[model samples]
Target: MTIKWEALLQVFGATLLVTVLVVTLFVIGIRALSDEKKGPAYASFAGCVAVVLYGLSLIVF
Candidate 1:
């Protein structure tokens, strides 16, 4: 069987991008909480959850 390098690279890039985005959002949320910024902290946590749910939906559906 032949491997599709292009497709593999595309998947790798997408995974890396998503991983960074999620981690960044989580970190921002933590920082916001520590700084006593409730609004931004909630928003950041929500963003992280949304991304995770989207990823799960992509895999499931």
Candidate 2:
């Protein structure tokens, strides 16, 4: 069977992009919380959590 190099690279690129995006979001949430700002901090944390859960759902289904 022949391997599809282009598809492989596309998937790899997408995975890398998503991983970076999620980690960046998590870091932003932590930084926001550390700064002791209430409204935005909570919003950031909630957003991070939502993204994480969405990722998990993608993996499961």
Candidate 3:
């Protein structure tokens, strides 16, 4: 069965999926880091934020 809003929902679904994946990866990454290696992880986090913003813009506009 197909719904009329499938196209809109596709964008929403992708955003939700990526959000979960990123959070899971970030949690694993943070846990795996040693005390001294956090700098790079934080940098990676900032990169993630950029990606999220871009995806958000796509879904929003």
* Pairs with steric clashes in candidate 2: none
Decreasing lDDT order of the candidates: 1, 2, 3
* C-alpha lDDT values of all predictions: 0.97, 0.82, 0.76
Rank candidates by TM-score, best first: 1, 2, 3
The residue-by-residue lDDT of candidate 2 on 1-61, one tens digit each, is 9999999999999889878887887777778778877777777667778878888999999
Error of 1 at 28 (Å): 0.5
Against the correct fold, how does model 1 do in TM-score?
Answer: 0.97
Winning candidate number (TM-score): 1
Taking all chains together, each candidate's TM-score versus the true structure is: 0.97, 0.73, 0.51
After superposing candidate 1, which stretches have Cα over 4 Å from the reference? none
In model 1, the number of clashes is: 0
* Clash counts for the predictions, in order: 0, 0, 0
Error of 2 at 14 (Å): 0.6
Candidate 1 local Cα displacement, residue 48, angstroms: 0.5
